[model samples]
Target: MASLKSLTKTLGGKDIWMLTLGKGDAESKPAIAVVGGVEGSHLLSVEMALRFAEGIISDHSDVLDNTTFYVFPNMSPDAYEQYFAALKWERSGNARPTDDDRDGRLNEDPFDDLDGNGMITWMRVEDPTGDWITHPADSRIMIKADRSKGEKGMYKVFTEGRDNDLDGTFNEDGEGGIHFRKNLTYEYPYFVAGSGEHSVSELENRALLDMLYTKWNLYGVFTFGPGNNLSSPWRYNRAGASKRVVTSILNDDAGLNKYLSDIYNETVSLKNAPDSGEQGGDFLQWAYFHFGRLSVGTPGWWVPTVKDEEGQAANKDKNREVNFLRWAEQEGLTNYWVDWKEVNHPDFPNQKVEVGGIAPFVMNNPPLAKIGDAARNHTDFIVKMAKMQANVQLVNLKTEAVGKGMTRITVDVYNGGTLPTHTEMGTRSRWLQPVKVELSLGNGQELISGRKIQTLRSLDGDASVQFTWLVKGSGTVKIQAGASHAGVDSQTVNLK
Candidate 1:
C-alpha cells in the first residue's frame, strides 16, 4: 500500500526494489512471473500487479510454496512518478528526457492541461483547409475528410496544449523517454521517432534477464503486454484488428504454435505487421530463438467484444463497446460519455469540443474501484500458466543384466512443455541460465564407468534428454530430472 519506492533493500544504497515485489521461497511448486507497468502511464497494470501479489499471499498461500510469484509491478517507476505528480510527459521510458521533436529543444515544451480538467484531452484547431471533419453520424468521433464527396475539412486535432515553444507547433517535443516497446530488437520499426537506437535504459531489461533468464530452471515464460499476439479469435488479414505481427514471428515453430493455439482458445493468429518487418530484438523471440525454450507474449486484458457494427449485423456477435459498458456499469464509472459536449478550444475556438472517446480513465486505465476484480482475474491466468510450465514427464527408464557382476541402466528425459529445460532466448542472449540435469544414486558399492550425468544446456519442447549409469552388480537405481520453476519428476528401474 505504501509507495513502491518503500519496499527495497540497501543494495549499496541509492534506493531500489520500489519497482519489484513478492517474497521469495526455496520450496518448489509452480512458479509464475508477473510483469506489469512496462509502460508508465498504464497505472492499472502496477495497481493490479500489486493487488494480485497480495491476493495470492493472503488467499492462496497453499500453492505459494509450489509456485513462486515474481512481481514487477512498475518496470518504469520513474516514468510513473511523472503521472502521479501531474507532469504531462508520462510515456513508457524512465525519467530520462529525449528530444521528441528533434527541434534542438529537449522536452522543454511538453503538452499541458491548460483547462485543468485533470485530463490531457485533444485540442481541435478550426481550419478551413483541415483534412478532418466532424462525423455526421457521431459528432463525438472525427472522420477523415472525403474530398471526393465534396466534404470540406473543418479542424485539425492536437493534444491539449498551447504554443508553449512559440515555434507555432502544438506538441512537437514534449518530455520524458521514448517508447520502450519500440526498443525491442524484434522487427522493430526502424527509423521510428521513439524507438531508442540502443538499449538506453537497461534497468528493467537487464533485471529481467539477470533474474529470470539466468535461472536455468525457468523453462517456460508467459509475458503480459499490450498486444495479444497469441490470441487468435478469428480469420487473418483484418488490418489493424488481426494479429498479423505475431503470425510471422512464430511461423517457423509450427509445433509450438499449434500447442499455444490449443492452450489459448485458438485466438492466437499468425500474421506480420505490414510496416515493421521481422524483428530479431523482441524479448519473446529472443527467448525462443536463443534460449531454446517455450515462451509467449500475451496482453493481460482482453476486450470481450471485437466490434459493434459487426455484432449488430450478425445479431449474435458481441461488441467491444458492450463489454466496456458492462465494466463501466459494474464499477459505477462515468468518466466516458457517448454524448458530445460543447466547449471552445483555443486552437479551434469556434468548433465544438466533444470528450467522448476511448474513455482513457476507465478502459485505458481502470480505476482502483475495479483493481481487485481485475487482479483476481489475472492471478488465475498466471496460475494457469504456472501449471502449464511444469514439464513433469516420464520419458523412459530401462535396465538390463550384462553378466554375473555387471549391469547397465539408461534413462530418457523429455520436456513435454513447449519450453525446454531452459529458455532458448535466454541462453542465446546470455540472459538465461544453462539447463541443468541431475542424477542421484542411492546405494553405492562399486561405481561403474558412467555413474553421474548432467547437461549444461538443453533444447526446446519434445526433445529428449538422455542419461546413463553402469553398475557393478544387479541393483535398483532412481533418477530424477529437475528444472527451475518447472518443478521435478523422477523414476526408478531395477537391473538384473
Candidate 2:
C-alpha cells in the first residue's frame, strides 16, 4: 500500500487513484488474494499464502507490474495464537461463548481433552440406544441410524470427550473468541458454537475486510479452506450425490477443469463425507455474487486412501476409498493411535480411546518434507494468473471534425480485470467509488480534446463507460486511461 501511495504521489494526485476493490467494481483481475488458516489448527493456510507471495516477489517481475497481488499470510492471526497457546484447539471461532445448542445455556458445555494427550480425538460411548452405530464394513467408522435396514445403532460418537457444560451436550462450544469467517455476512454456521452475527465481528476479520474494500483492484480470490482445487477429480466431478457440498459450474471459456480433475482424482479417494448444510454466508459466494468475479475456495491439502487388502487397483464405483488409505500411508502421516488406551470418561464408563485420522502436520497439512513442493506448485499457479490480468484495452474511440473548426473526441474506458468497476447495486448504494478515466493535452497550453472522465468511486472487470469532448483547431491530445487493477495507459492522436 505504501508503494501504491508513492506511485500516486509521483503522478499528479489526479492520475494516480486508489479505489477499493471488494464488492463494487467493474471487473476483478486474475490477481489471486489468499487468506489462510480460517480455522485455528490449519496453520498450513498461512504457509500456502506466504509461499505464493514469496514466489511472486522473488521470481515473477512482469506479473508484479501488470497484476496486483495482495497476501494476508494469516488472516486469522488471533486464532493461530490461540491454537498455539492452548495446544489443543480445533476451533474455527475466536473464543466467544454463545448458546450453540440453544438449550438456554451459552457455551456452557464443550468437548474436553480428558486423557490430556495434547490432542482432541473422537470418543465413542457404548450407548445401546445411541443414534450412531459402528459401520459393519469398517469397524473404525461410524454410521447413522437406519430403521429400514434392520441394523441398530449402539454407539454414540462425539467430538473426542465429555461435555464441559455438564448439561449433557458434548462438544457444543469449546474454546476461542470469535470466528471471523463465520462472523462475515457470507456462509456463517450461525447459532452453532462460535459464529457471531455478521461477517468480520473479530478484529482480524475487520482488518481483512478493510483491506479488501480499500484495495478495489483485487479481482480474483483463491481462498485456502475446506473447498477443493480447480484442478482434477474434485474439480471435474460434481458434488454428485452430495448436494450439500456443490461447486459452481465452470465458464465455457475456462477449459482448465481437465487439469483440475486429474489432480483431485489422482490424490484422494473417498472414505466418508459428512452431510452438507446450507451455507448461509459463504466468502466465495459473496465475492462472486457481489463482485461478478471468479472466487475459488480450495482445501490446501488432500489425502488419498485405499481399502484393498490384496493391494489391487481400485474399482470404478469406490475410487475414493482406494485413494484415501493409499495417501495416508504413502505420505507417512502419523496414525496418532497408541494401542487403544483405556480411558474412563464421565459420559462413557466403559470405552476405549482410538486416535485415528490423518495425524498432525500430515494429511490435512503437507508433511514437513514436502511443504516446499506444495508452496512451489501454488506459487506457480498464482504467478500464471497474475500475468493474465488485462492491463488496458481500446474498446471504442470516435473522432469527428465538427461543421466548422471544432472536433469532437469520444472514447470509452474498459476494465478487463476479472472483477467489475462497481459491484452490486447494494455496494453502490453504500457509496462505493467506481474507477475513473481521464483525458488531457499531451503538452503546452492546449485544452483541445476533453476533461477528466470519472466512474464509480471504484471500477471492476468488464466495467466501462465513454467520455466525449468538443475542441477547436487542428492540434494533438492525450487520452489517458487508468484503473486500480490494470494500472495506467496513455494514447496520443492528432485532432486535425
Candidate 3:
C-alpha cells in the first residue's frame, strides 16, 4: 500500500508531499527514506527522487515486503520553482525574508540580469587588483592566479548585479532566504549566511525534522543532493571520529559506508565522481551524526568528461566550469553558455565587465533527456539496499526437562542480515530503542530463572546470543525479538 501525504508547507506555502510505500502504514516496516531537494539549486535531485518513487510504485513493490520507502521528492519547492521563474538563478534558500548579510535589511542588493538574458550569470571585471585570471587550459574559463606559476591576476568575478543598497556589496543579500540545506542541527553553522538564526529554524527544516524524529522504523536515509558519499565513501578519520563531539564517520559506520559505496558504484553508470566536500549543516551529516541512521547522498549527475576531436577524454584540468563547457559543447547543448557579452555596469563604470558564464543550473544538472538514465539506475540501487536491512531469527531452539515441573527454554536471538540491528552512530547516540527480546509465558506458567524481557545494545550481522528462561508448568511459550526498524520474529514452543 502507498500513502500520499502533505506533511507540511514551506514558508512560501508550497506543499511538501512525502510518499509512504509499504505493506501497511509507513511505520509498520523498516524504512529507508529517500530525500530530495536538499539543495534547492540541484533540481535534478527532485526528479531523481520522483523517478525512484515511480519505479517502486509501478514495478518494484515487492521490496515493500521488507523495506518501506518514505520519498520526499522536493523539500525546497519555494527555491526549486525559481528555476522556472522569470529571472533564473541558482537559489538554495526558501522564500522567507532573511537578512543574509545580517545588515538589518531584507532582500537588499539582489542579483540583476544585466544582459536581460533572464538568468543570473557570472560577471567578469577586468582589473589589475583582481586575483582571478582566465584559465590557461581554457581561455573561456577563469582560475585564480598562481604567483609561483607567473600568472598575473587580470579579472574580478561576481554575480551579475549592482550595489543597490550602496553597501559596497554586489548581491550580498537576495530574495532567496534561509536554506533547508544549511539549517540542520548537526554541525550547525551558527550565524552563517543562508543558515537561519538557529538550526532547524526554517519551516521546511523544522517540518522534515519533526517527521524524521517520529519515524522510529527508519533504518537508513538516501538523499539526492550535493553532499555525496555514495560515489566515493569518506574515509574514517580517527581524530574527527574520536572527538567528544563526533564529526567524522565512526569506524564501524565507515566500513559499512565502504560496503554500500561499492554497491552504489556498481549500480550507477556514472564514474570518476569528485568527492562531495564537507558542508556544515547539511542533512547528509545530520542524518548520521545526530539522527543516528545510515545516510548516503549523491548529486545524481555531474558534467561528464568531454571528448576531443580525436575522440579522447579532454580537459584534464579538473576545473568544473572548464570541464562543463567542454562537455556542453561536445553534447551540442545550446543556450548553456552565455558567450561573454560586454555589458556596461554602473559599479564598474570605468572598467571592462563582461556578463557571461555557464547558464544557471546546467553544470550540476543534466539535460532533461539524460535524467531518465540516472533516475532508473538510482532506483535499482535503492532497491538493492533492502538486502541489508536487519532480520531477526530464532536459531537453535532447545528445551530440556530440568525438573518435574520446571522446563529450561533456550533460544539464540540472532541477526541474520549484513547490517547490525543498530547503526554504529545509533549506538553512540543511544536514541534508538535497542533490540528487545521477550518471553511471553503461557497460562499458569511461572518464570523461575532468566529475564522475561531483555535488551541487547546491538547485534552485528550473523551474530547471536543465547537467551534462556526457566518456566514452571508451561503449556506453550512465545519468544519474540527485534526492533521496529529491525525485522521482527517469533516462535511458539510446546512444553510437556
Q: Give the candidate number with the greatest lDDT.
A: 3
Residue lDDT tens for model 3, 425-491: 9998999889989999877999899988999988998899999888899589899999998878899
Per-residue lDDT tens digits for candidate 1, residues 89-205, read 336555456776677778877776655666565655567867877655335456678899899999777666667777778766666464545555455556555565564234455
Candidate scoring better on TM-score of 1 and 3: 3
Pairs that collide in candidate 3 are: none
Residue-level error in angstroms, candidate 1, position 90: 5.9
Give the distance in Å from residue 437's predicted Cα in candidate 1 to where it truly belongs: 5.0
Model 3 vs truth, CA RMSD: 1.6
TM-score: the better of candidates 2 and 3: 3
User: Judged by lDDT against the true structure, how good is candidate 1?
Assistant: 0.54
Residue-level lDDT tens digits of model 2 in 1-496: 1122211111111111222112222234324567666555567877787666666656664564455565555545555554465545455555455666667766656556666776666666667777876544445555676879787878677776666667776777555456555566655565654566555565555555666776556656667665543532223234521344334433321233343334433443332432121254545455544444445555555554345556554343443333454555555656533233457765555564443332333335555676776677666665555554545555678888775667787777766655343333324234433355666654343445456565445444566667788766667877776655445566675776
Off by over 4 Å in 3: 307-316
lDDT of 2: 0.53
Each candidate: how many clashes? 34, 76, 0
Model 1, C-alpha of 285: deviation from truth (Å)? 5.7
What is the lDDT of every predicted structure here? 0.54, 0.53, 0.87
